[model samples]
Target: MKIHLTSVLVDDQAAALHFYTEVLGFLKKHDVPLGEQDRWLTVVSPEEPGGTELLLEPARHPAARTYRDALVEDGIPLAQFTVDDVAAEYERLSALGVRFTQKPLETGPVTTAVLDDTCGNLIQIASRPR
Candidate 1:
């Protein structure tokens, strides 16, 4: 079966939506109420709307809480995005007041950096050699 959906453990789905959409330039695709004050929300890339959807799910469940906590403790990233120019993208986003954890650094044929997604997530942006 094809993988239909993927999800991210967020502390607040609404805030995650804002960060992904407003800051990261994603567009909201689906938002439906799942429970009282709970929602099933997803965001997609504007340039590649059919590429993939990022589920903005809450981490109130025990398993999600543990996973997110462990990731944060280990200082690992929750997700990564491929870019054509890591430094340029980093500077563009930074000028928009985006906070980054690391600046672009070359690692072999790829240059990469990390940014605070503002949703309890570390997002890595990388530019790989062709």
Candidate 2:
């Protein structure tokens, strides 16, 4: 009846961790090594520590690579995160050197921006009038 966790396929988990935490401000929740090269890593929004977690899953499967690559090639975002102010968040992130494919644009009552996650995914940040 409720959402629990979701994931983004990442080319490098370590780099994704840094970008999601240090840049995007999510807090690390779980970090367990699954094998010699992979770890069961997840992060939660700082504002909702007990909310759904976002897993930074490794893109080890060939299908995952093809899917992600195709999405990127088509300028589609793999995931979207909600924020309070899309414009402010876009400015803050841009100042940190995050490359955005789409700048904040208003569409009806909602605004959104898309940025590269730096670990092989395009992410969208969105906000709607409160």
Number of the top-ranking candidate, with TM-score as the measure:
2
TM-score per prediction, in order, is 0.89, 0.97
Off by over 4 Å in 2: none
lDDT of 1 at 50: 89
lDDT of 1 by residue, 46-95 (tens): 87888778889887887876776677666677888888899899988999
- Ten-residue region with minimum lDDT total, candidate 2: 121-130
Q: How many steric clashes between backbone atoms does each model show?
A: 0, 0
Per-model root-mean-square deviation over C-alphas: 1.6, 0.9
Q: Lowest summed lDDT over 10 consecutive residues: which window, candidate 1?
A: 66-75
Q: Per-residue lDDT for 32-98 in model 2, tens only?
A: 9998999999999999999999999999998998899899988799999999999899989999999
lDDT of each: 0.84, 0.95
